[model samples]
Target: MNSQDETQIAVLRNLYAKQAHLIDTGQHEGWAQTFTADGEFHSPTYGEPAIGHDQLADISRRFSESAQQAGERHRHVIENIWVTECDGSSAQVRAYVMIVGTDIERKQARILRIVTNIDQLEKSADGWLIRHRKVEY
Candidate 1:
């Protein structure tokens, strides 16, 4: 890989890290900003795909609120991330996600779900933004 390619991969990896931290800390709005304006998040866990930043924010907020109400702590562990393909303007990436959750009553955290994320990212004026993210079991 060329230096530019490596840099792009690094950026995408950082993006994943930022996304995990933002969602884990209940920063839904900030997390939403990681996507493009018309970005989409598709997850079987969510029932339907969340389209656009507005919908993404709503879904994220719902998840955050639900977790808060249940006194649940969630940690999104992203690993085995790889950039499968990259053009100058776009890339395809994949990663494994393991969600660990702990209830307030229980001090121990346990694995809740494991899935793989397939993502399409595009280079935007601001920076690289996620155009579509599909989560699969």
Candidate 2:
């Protein structure tokens, strides 16, 4: 790969890593920002789907609030990033994800989620961000 290709790849990776860290840090707003204005989070665990920025923010807010109440620690690991397109302006990213939530009171650790996301992204002046993410179990 050339230098420019390598740079675009790095930028995409940063987007994934940033959201993962934000999730662990309980920064749901930051997480929502990683998505486009019309981004969607399609997780069956939540029952109702969140579509659009404000809805996504509210949904994530509730999730974050619940996590805070539970006082559990979380870690979201993203791996196997496969970039189908990386021209910089837009790209497709596929990644494996495993989220673990450990209950402090129970002192237990368990796998929370094992899944993958086929993410459609757009590159803006600010950076690369997810335009849409189709999540599959």
Candidate 3:
């Protein structure tokens, strides 16, 4: 791979890590900003795909609230990330996600789900943003 590819890959890796941190910390708005303005997220567990940043933020907020209400914690382990394709301005990425859920009261944590995330990313003025993300369990 060329240096440019290496740099892009690094940036993509950082993006994934940042995304996980945002979600884990319940930074819903910050997490939503990782997406493009018109980005879409498809999750089987979420009932329907969330389209656009507003919808995405709403979903994030709902999830955060639900977890908080239940006294639960979520940690998303993103691993095995592969940049399947990359151009100067866009890339296709796939990664495995393992969500660990913790019960604050019981101080117990367990793997809640495992899935593969396929993301379509684009380079915008703000840097790389997710154009679409489809989650497969």
Candidate 1 RMSD to the correct structure: 1.2
Single out the weakest 10-residue window by summed lDDT for candidate 1.
62-71
Point out the worst 10-residue segment of candidate 3 by lDDT: 61-70
TM-score, each model? Answer: 0.94, 0.87, 0.95
Write one digit per residue (lDDT tens) for candidate 2, span 1-137: 89999888887888889988886776778888888878777777677768787777776677667666877777778999988888768999999988787888998988878989888898877788788777778
Off by over 4 Å in 1: none
Residue 53 of model 2, lDDT score: 72
- Model 2 lDDT, full chain set: 0.81
Q: For candidate 3, lDDT tens digit of each residue in 10-51?
A: 999999999999978878889999999999999997979999
Q: How close is candidate 3 to the true structure, as a TM-score?
A: 0.95
Per-prediction tally of clashes: 0, 0, 0
Determine which window of 10 residues in candidate 2 has minimal summed lDDT: 59-68
Candidates, ranked, lDDT: 3, 1, 2
Clashing pairs in 3: none
Best by lDDT: 3
Note the Cα lDDT for every prediction shown.
0.90, 0.81, 0.92
Per-residue lDDT of model 1, residues 29-68, tens digit only: 8899899999999999888899988889887887787777
